[model samples]
Target: MTREPTVAEQSHPNYVKVWGVLVALLAVSVVGPMFEIKLVTLVTAFGVAILKAYLVARNFMHLHIERRYVTYLLVGMVALMLLLFAGVAPDVMKHEGHQWKNEAAQKVVRDAAPAAKVH
Candidate 1:
C-alpha cells in the first residue's frame, strides 16, 4: 500500500514555473554586464541574485509553509553574520593599520584602481 504524503510535502507548488523564472533571471544576470553600464551591471547582478535566492528558498526549501521560527532563525543567523562582517571589514580592508603597513597590498590596490575605473 502507498503511504500518504505528510502535510509538509502535500501542498505542491509549480516548480517548473519557478525554474523558468530562475533561468530567465540567470540569463539576464549574464547578459547585463555586456552593456558595460555600472549601474545596470550592479542592479542585474545583485537584484537577480537576491531574487533567485528567494525563489530557491521559498519554492524548493518550502520555507514559506514551514514553521515561522525556522525563517526567523535563518534571518537571525544571517543578520549576525552581516554584523560580524561589518565589525571586521574596516580593519581587514585597510592596507595599513596602527604601527603596521602592507606595501604589497597598497601597491596592488593602486595598480588596480585605474583598471577598475575603466569599467
Candidate 2:
C-alpha cells in the first residue's frame, strides 16, 4: 500500500527554495572575498558549490523523493571523493618539495652567472 503526502510536503514552496539558492549564492560571494590564499579560496568555493548543488538536488530534482538506499549511495560517494582527494594530496606535497629544490638550484645558477661574467 502507498502512503499519502503530509500537508507540509503537499505543496512545493518554490519561493523557499529560491531563497535558499539566493542565500547560498550570497554566502559564497561573502565568503570568497574574505580569504586571500588560493587554496583556501578554492576550498571555500567548492564548499559553497556543494551547498548550492545540494539545494538544487533536494528541491528541484526532488532528491527527497528518493529512497534511503539512494541517500546512502550519495553519502558513500561523497566519502569516496574525500578519500580520493586525500590520496592525491600526499603526492602533491611530495612533488612540491622537488619543485622547491629545483627552484633553489635555479636561483644559485642565476646568482653565479653574473660572477662568471666578471671573471
Tell me the alpha-carbon RMSD of every candidate.
3.6, 8.7
**Candidate 1, after superposition: displacement of residue 64 in Å?**
0.4
- In candidate 1, list every pair of residues with a backbone clash: none
Question: Candidate 1's residue-wise lDDT over 3-100, tens digit each?
Answer: 96653585678999989999999999999989989999998998889999999998888888888999999999999999999999987798898899
lDDT of 1 at 100: 90
Could you tell me how far off, in angstroms, the CA of residue 70 lies in candidate 2 after the best superposition?
A: 0.7
**RMSD in Å for model 2:** 8.7
Which lDDT tens digits does candidate 2 get at residues 1-119? Answer: 89876533754757676776768786875688587777767766776677777777776656677666877898899999999999987765443363555556566777899999998
lDDT of 1 at 108: 92
How many clashes in candidate 1? 0
